[model samples]
Target: MKINKNIAISDSGFVFNPVNGESFSVNPIGAEIIDMMKTEKSYEEIHKTLISKYNADEATIEKDYFDFVGLLKQHNLIDNNEEA
Candidate 1:
Protein backbone atom coordinates (compact mmCIF):
# COMPACT_ATOMS: atom_id res chain seq x y z
CA MET A 1 0.00 0.00 0.00
CA LYS A 2 1.08 3.52 -0.71
CA ILE A 3 1.23 6.29 1.89
CA ASN A 4 -1.28 9.09 1.44
CA LYS A 5 0.17 12.32 0.13
CA ASN A 6 -1.40 14.20 3.00
CA ILE A 7 0.48 12.07 5.49
CA ALA A 8 3.82 13.13 6.88
CA ILE A 9 6.32 10.62 8.18
CA SER A 10 9.50 11.55 9.94
CA ASP A 11 12.77 9.64 10.20
CA SER A 12 12.07 9.25 13.90
CA GLY A 13 8.81 7.41 13.17
CA PHE A 14 6.44 10.23 13.92
CA VAL A 15 3.44 9.86 11.62
CA PHE A 16 0.97 12.59 10.88
CA ASN A 17 -2.05 12.10 8.65
CA PRO A 18 -3.32 15.55 7.84
CA VAL A 19 -6.36 14.31 5.97
CA ASN A 20 -7.53 12.37 8.98
CA GLY A 21 -6.21 14.88 11.48
CA GLU A 22 -4.48 12.08 13.30
CA SER A 23 -1.00 11.76 14.67
CA PHE A 24 0.86 8.74 15.92
CA SER A 25 4.28 7.49 16.83
CA VAL A 26 5.89 4.21 15.93
CA ASN A 27 8.91 2.25 16.98
CA PRO A 28 11.89 1.70 14.75
CA ILE A 29 10.60 -1.58 13.39
CA GLY A 30 7.23 -0.08 12.62
CA ALA A 31 8.93 2.82 10.90
CA GLU A 32 10.95 0.50 8.72
CA ILE A 33 7.91 -1.53 7.77
CA ILE A 34 5.86 1.56 7.00
CA ASP A 35 8.59 3.04 4.84
CA MET A 36 8.79 -0.16 2.88
CA MET A 37 5.03 -0.23 2.40
CA LYS A 38 5.12 3.35 1.17
CA THR A 39 7.61 2.28 -1.48
CA GLU A 40 4.99 -0.17 -2.78
CA LYS A 41 6.94 -3.22 -1.70
CA SER A 42 5.10 -6.50 -2.09
CA TYR A 43 4.33 -8.70 0.87
CA GLU A 44 6.94 -11.23 -0.12
CA GLU A 45 9.59 -8.59 -0.53
CA ILE A 46 8.81 -6.96 2.79
CA HIS A 47 8.62 -10.30 4.52
CA LYS A 48 11.99 -11.34 3.21
CA THR A 49 13.63 -8.11 4.26
CA LEU A 50 12.16 -8.19 7.71
CA ILE A 51 13.05 -11.81 8.17
CA SER A 52 16.67 -11.08 7.36
CA LYS A 53 16.89 -7.88 9.30
CA TYR A 54 15.08 -8.94 12.43
CA ASN A 55 15.94 -12.63 12.37
CA ALA A 56 12.24 -13.34 12.72
CA ASP A 57 10.52 -16.49 11.61
CA GLU A 58 8.21 -16.54 8.61
CA ALA A 59 5.03 -16.98 10.60
CA THR A 60 5.87 -14.19 13.00
CA ILE A 61 6.75 -11.68 10.29
CA GLU A 62 3.70 -12.61 8.27
CA LYS A 63 1.40 -12.05 11.21
CA ASP A 64 2.99 -8.76 12.14
CA TYR A 65 2.98 -7.53 8.56
CA PHE A 66 -0.68 -8.37 8.17
CA ASP A 67 -1.45 -6.45 11.33
CA PHE A 68 0.53 -3.48 10.10
CA VAL A 69 -1.23 -3.55 6.76
CA GLY A 70 -4.55 -3.81 8.50
CA LEU A 71 -3.74 -0.67 10.48
CA LEU A 72 -2.98 1.20 7.28
CA LYS A 73 -6.24 0.05 5.79
CA GLN A 74 -8.13 1.00 8.91
CA HIS A 75 -6.79 4.52 8.75
CA ASN A 76 -7.38 4.77 4.98
CA LEU A 77 -3.75 5.72 4.68
CA ILE A 78 -3.38 3.46 1.72
CA ASP A 79 -4.88 4.00 -1.68
CA ASN A 80 -7.36 1.62 -3.37
CA ASN A 81 -4.88 0.79 -6.10
CA GLU A 82 -2.49 -0.60 -3.51
CA GLU A 83 -5.03 -2.63 -1.58
CA ALA A 84 -3.99 -6.23 -1.06
Candidate 2:
Protein backbone atom coordinates (compact mmCIF):
# COMPACT_ATOMS: atom_id res chain seq x y z
CA MET A 1 0.00 0.00 0.00
CA LYS A 2 1.03 3.55 -0.55
CA ILE A 3 1.24 5.99 2.31
CA ASN A 4 -1.20 8.85 1.90
CA LYS A 5 0.10 12.14 0.59
CA ASN A 6 -0.88 13.86 3.79
CA ILE A 7 1.13 11.45 5.87
CA ALA A 8 4.81 11.59 6.60
CA ILE A 9 6.64 8.45 7.63
CA SER A 10 10.12 8.22 9.05
CA ASP A 11 12.51 5.31 8.89
CA SER A 12 12.24 5.05 12.63
CA GLY A 13 8.47 4.27 12.51
CA PHE A 14 7.11 7.71 13.29
CA VAL A 15 3.98 8.56 11.30
CA PHE A 16 2.35 11.95 11.08
CA ASN A 17 -0.93 12.44 9.27
CA PRO A 18 -1.64 16.02 8.37
CA VAL A 19 -5.23 15.25 7.40
CA ASN A 20 -6.07 14.00 10.88
CA GLY A 21 -3.63 16.29 12.60
CA GLU A 22 -2.31 13.33 14.51
CA SER A 23 0.93 11.46 14.90
CA PHE A 24 1.73 7.88 15.78
CA SER A 25 4.72 5.66 16.25
CA VAL A 26 5.35 1.95 15.66
CA ASN A 27 8.04 -0.52 16.56
CA PRO A 28 10.87 -1.52 14.23
CA ILE A 29 8.97 -4.50 12.86
CA GLY A 30 5.92 -2.38 12.12
CA ALA A 31 8.04 0.27 10.52
CA GLU A 32 9.73 -2.18 8.22
CA ILE A 33 6.41 -3.66 7.28
CA ILE A 34 5.01 -0.25 6.43
CA ASP A 35 8.07 0.64 4.43
CA MET A 36 7.70 -2.51 2.38
CA MET A 37 4.05 -1.78 1.83
CA LYS A 38 5.00 1.66 0.63
CA THR A 39 7.00 -0.05 -2.07
CA GLU A 40 3.81 -1.81 -3.16
CA LYS A 41 5.18 -5.20 -2.35
CA SER A 42 2.87 -8.12 -2.97
CA TYR A 43 1.63 -10.21 -0.03
CA GLU A 44 3.83 -13.08 -1.14
CA GLU A 45 6.88 -10.85 -1.26
CA ILE A 46 6.22 -9.47 2.18
CA HIS A 47 5.58 -12.88 3.60
CA LYS A 48 8.67 -14.31 2.02
CA THR A 49 10.85 -11.51 3.23
CA LEU A 50 9.58 -11.80 6.75
CA ILE A 51 9.95 -15.55 6.69
CA SER A 52 13.54 -15.25 5.61
CA LYS A 53 14.49 -12.57 8.06
CA TYR A 54 12.41 -13.14 11.15
CA ASN A 55 11.72 -16.00 13.52
CA ALA A 56 8.00 -15.86 12.91
CA ASP A 57 5.97 -18.40 10.95
CA GLU A 58 3.77 -17.91 7.87
CA ALA A 59 0.49 -18.09 9.72
CA THR A 60 1.47 -15.39 12.20
CA ILE A 61 2.92 -13.12 9.58
CA GLU A 62 -0.09 -13.57 7.34
CA LYS A 63 -2.52 -12.60 10.05
CA ASP A 64 -0.49 -9.66 11.27
CA TYR A 65 0.15 -8.35 7.78
CA PHE A 66 -3.53 -8.29 6.92
CA ASP A 67 -4.39 -6.77 10.27
CA PHE A 68 -1.75 -4.11 9.88
CA VAL A 69 -3.02 -3.24 6.43
CA GLY A 70 -6.50 -2.96 7.80
CA LEU A 71 -5.30 -0.57 10.47
CA LEU A 72 -3.54 1.53 7.85
CA LYS A 73 -6.76 1.69 5.87
CA GLN A 74 -8.74 2.63 8.96
CA HIS A 75 -6.33 5.45 9.68
CA ASN A 76 -6.45 6.60 6.04
CA LEU A 77 -2.76 6.03 5.79
CA ILE A 78 -3.09 4.06 2.55
CA ASP A 79 -5.52 4.22 -0.33
CA ASN A 80 -7.72 1.51 -1.84
CA ASN A 81 -5.80 1.35 -5.08
CA GLU A 82 -2.63 0.66 -3.17
CA GLU A 83 -3.85 -2.30 -1.20
CA ALA A 84 -2.24 -5.69 -1.70
Candidate 3:
Protein backbone atom coordinates (compact mmCIF):
# COMPACT_ATOMS: atom_id res chain seq x y z
CA MET A 1 0.00 0.00 0.00
CA LYS A 2 0.99 3.60 -0.47
CA ILE A 3 1.04 6.35 2.07
CA ASN A 4 -1.00 9.41 1.24
CA LYS A 5 1.18 11.62 -0.94
CA ASN A 6 0.43 14.77 1.00
CA ILE A 7 1.39 13.45 4.40
CA ALA A 8 4.32 15.17 6.06
CA ILE A 9 6.64 13.07 8.12
CA SER A 10 9.50 14.13 10.33
CA ASP A 11 12.59 12.39 11.59
CA SER A 12 11.34 12.93 15.12
CA GLY A 13 8.23 10.84 14.49
CA PHE A 14 5.79 13.66 13.92
CA VAL A 15 3.27 12.90 11.17
CA PHE A 16 0.97 15.45 9.64
CA ASN A 17 -1.85 14.58 7.28
CA PRO A 18 -2.49 17.54 5.05
CA VAL A 19 -5.79 16.32 3.67
CA ASN A 20 -7.40 16.11 7.10
CA GLY A 21 -5.23 18.66 8.88
CA GLU A 22 -4.55 16.14 11.61
CA SER A 23 -1.28 15.38 13.37
CA PHE A 24 0.00 12.25 14.97
CA SER A 25 3.12 10.81 16.53
CA VAL A 26 4.56 7.36 16.29
CA ASN A 27 7.32 5.36 17.91
CA PRO A 28 10.67 4.92 16.19
CA ILE A 29 9.66 1.66 14.57
CA GLY A 30 6.44 3.15 13.29
CA ALA A 31 8.36 6.10 11.94
CA GLU A 32 10.68 3.75 10.09
CA ILE A 33 7.73 1.94 8.61
CA ILE A 34 6.23 5.20 7.41
CA ASP A 35 9.50 6.26 5.89
CA MET A 36 9.71 3.02 3.98
CA MET A 37 6.17 3.44 2.76
CA LYS A 38 6.97 6.96 1.67
CA THR A 39 9.67 5.56 -0.57
CA GLU A 40 7.22 3.03 -2.03
CA LYS A 41 8.97 0.07 -0.54
CA SER A 42 7.26 -3.27 -0.88
CA TYR A 43 5.89 -5.19 2.06
CA GLU A 44 8.47 -7.95 1.78
CA GLU A 45 11.27 -5.42 1.72
CA ILE A 46 9.94 -3.73 4.83
CA HIS A 47 9.50 -7.05 6.56
CA LYS A 48 13.06 -8.07 5.79
CA THR A 49 14.52 -4.79 6.96
CA LEU A 50 12.63 -4.83 10.22
CA ILE A 51 13.52 -8.42 10.89
CA SER A 52 17.22 -7.77 10.31
CA LYS A 53 17.38 -4.59 12.38
CA TYR A 54 15.19 -5.70 15.25
CA ASN A 55 15.18 -8.76 17.44
CA ALA A 56 11.65 -9.76 16.60
CA ASP A 57 10.95 -12.98 14.76
CA GLU A 58 9.39 -13.25 11.33
CA ALA A 59 5.83 -13.94 12.50
CA THR A 60 5.72 -11.15 15.05
CA ILE A 61 7.03 -8.50 12.68
CA GLU A 62 4.56 -9.57 10.01
CA LYS A 63 1.67 -9.29 12.43
CA ASP A 64 2.75 -5.94 13.79
CA TYR A 65 3.36 -4.59 10.29
CA PHE A 66 -0.13 -5.45 9.11
CA ASP A 67 -1.62 -4.07 12.31
CA PHE A 68 0.15 -0.79 11.76
CA VAL A 69 -1.06 -0.69 8.17
CA GLY A 70 -4.58 -1.30 9.42
CA LEU A 71 -4.22 1.69 11.68
CA LEU A 72 -3.16 3.80 8.73
CA LYS A 73 -6.28 2.62 6.89
CA GLN A 74 -8.52 3.50 9.82
CA HIS A 75 -7.09 7.01 9.77
CA ASN A 76 -7.17 7.37 5.97
CA LEU A 77 -3.43 7.92 6.02
CA ILE A 78 -2.91 5.61 3.06
CA ASP A 79 -4.05 5.71 -0.52
CA ASN A 80 -7.36 3.87 -0.96
CA ASN A 81 -6.40 2.67 -4.42
CA GLU A 82 -3.55 0.52 -3.22
CA GLU A 83 -3.94 -3.10 -2.19
CA ALA A 84 -3.34 -3.96 1.43
Candidate 4:
Protein backbone atom coordinates (compact mmCIF):
# COMPACT_ATOMS: atom_id res chain seq x y z
CA MET A 1 0.00 0.00 0.00
CA LYS A 2 1.08 3.55 -0.63
CA ILE A 3 1.38 6.26 1.97
CA ASN A 4 -0.90 9.17 1.27
CA LYS A 5 0.60 11.82 -1.02
CA ASN A 6 0.28 14.62 1.49
CA ILE A 7 1.42 12.64 4.50
CA ALA A 8 4.80 13.42 6.01
CA ILE A 9 7.03 11.09 7.98
CA SER A 10 10.18 12.35 9.59
CA ASP A 11 13.40 10.35 9.96
CA SER A 12 12.76 10.28 13.68
CA GLY A 13 9.41 8.54 13.13
CA PHE A 14 7.14 11.50 13.59
CA VAL A 15 4.17 11.36 11.23
CA PHE A 16 1.89 14.16 10.15
CA ASN A 17 -1.20 14.27 8.01
CA PRO A 18 -1.82 17.70 6.58
CA VAL A 19 -5.35 16.98 5.50
CA ASN A 20 -6.69 16.04 8.91
CA GLY A 21 -4.12 17.84 11.00
CA GLU A 22 -3.33 14.59 12.78
CA SER A 23 0.09 13.58 13.97
CA PHE A 24 1.57 10.39 15.37
CA SER A 25 4.85 8.76 16.19
CA VAL A 26 6.04 5.25 15.54
CA ASN A 27 8.98 3.23 16.68
CA PRO A 28 12.12 2.72 14.65
CA ILE A 29 10.90 -0.40 12.87
CA GLY A 30 7.58 1.22 12.09
CA ALA A 31 9.43 4.19 10.67
CA GLU A 32 11.48 1.87 8.51
CA ILE A 33 8.36 0.26 7.14
CA ILE A 34 6.85 3.65 6.39
CA ASP A 35 10.00 4.69 4.60
CA MET A 36 9.84 1.55 2.48
CA MET A 37 6.20 2.14 1.73
CA LYS A 38 7.07 5.65 0.62
CA THR A 39 9.28 4.06 -2.01
CA GLU A 40 6.44 1.81 -3.22
CA LYS A 41 8.01 -1.40 -2.02
CA SER A 42 5.92 -4.53 -2.35
CA TYR A 43 4.69 -6.52 0.64
CA GLU A 44 6.98 -9.40 -0.17
CA GLU A 45 9.97 -7.11 -0.30
CA ILE A 46 9.08 -5.60 3.03
CA HIS A 47 8.60 -8.97 4.64
CA LYS A 48 11.85 -10.32 3.27
CA THR A 49 13.90 -7.33 4.26
CA LEU A 50 12.44 -7.15 7.74
CA ILE A 51 12.75 -10.86 8.33
CA SER A 52 16.38 -10.81 7.34
CA LYS A 53 17.32 -7.70 9.19
CA TYR A 54 15.57 -8.22 12.53
CA ASN A 55 16.54 -10.87 15.03
CA ALA A 56 13.03 -12.22 15.34
CA ASP A 57 11.86 -15.35 13.56
CA GLU A 58 9.83 -15.34 10.38
CA ALA A 59 6.52 -16.17 12.04
CA THR A 60 6.81 -13.44 14.65
CA ILE A 61 7.93 -10.87 12.15
CA GLU A 62 5.16 -11.82 9.77
CA LYS A 63 2.55 -11.56 12.48
CA ASP A 64 3.81 -8.22 13.71
CA TYR A 65 4.00 -6.92 10.16
CA PHE A 66 0.39 -7.74 9.56
CA ASP A 67 -0.60 -6.23 12.87
CA PHE A 68 1.35 -3.06 12.19
CA VAL A 69 -0.08 -2.68 8.72
CA GLY A 70 -3.53 -3.21 10.15
CA LEU A 71 -2.91 -0.41 12.63
CA LEU A 72 -1.81 1.85 9.77
CA LYS A 73 -5.02 1.03 7.94
CA GLN A 74 -7.14 1.63 11.01
CA HIS A 75 -5.43 4.97 11.57
CA ASN A 76 -5.88 6.01 7.90
CA LEU A 77 -2.19 6.45 7.37
CA ILE A 78 -2.10 4.49 4.14
CA ASP A 79 -3.94 5.07 0.90
CA ASN A 80 -6.77 2.63 0.36
CA ASN A 81 -7.43 3.53 -3.26
CA GLU A 82 -4.81 1.05 -4.52
CA GLU A 83 -4.34 -2.56 -3.55
CA ALA A 84 -1.04 -3.67 -2.16
Q: Estimate each model's TM-score.
A: 0.84, 0.81, 0.95, 0.91
Best model per TM-score: 3
Root-mean-square deviation per candidate? 1.7, 1.9, 0.8, 1.3
Query: Which prediction has more favorable TM-score, 2 or 3?
Result: 3
Tens-place lDDT digits, model 3, residues 1-84: 899989999999999998889999999999999999999999989998999999988999999999999999888999777788
* Model 4 RMSD, rounded to 1 decimal: 1.3
TM-score, prediction 2: 0.81
Q: Which stretches in model 1 have alpha-carbon errors above 4 Å?
A: 80-82
Cα lDDT tens digits for candidate 1, 1-84: 566767778999998988868888888998898888778778789888998888768898889888877787777777757766
Candidates arranged by lDDT, highest first: 3, 4, 1, 2
Tell me, by lDDT, which candidate is best.
3
The worst-scoring run of ten residues by lDDT in candidate 2 lies at: 1-10
Candidate 4 residue-wise lDDT, 1-84, digit = tens: 788878799989999989889999999999999999889899999999998898999999989988898888777888766564
In candidate 4, which residue pairs clash?
none
- The candidate 1 region of ten consecutive residues with least summed lDDT is 75-84
Model 1 earns a TM-score of: 0.84
Note the clash tally of each candidate.
Answer: 0, 0, 0, 0
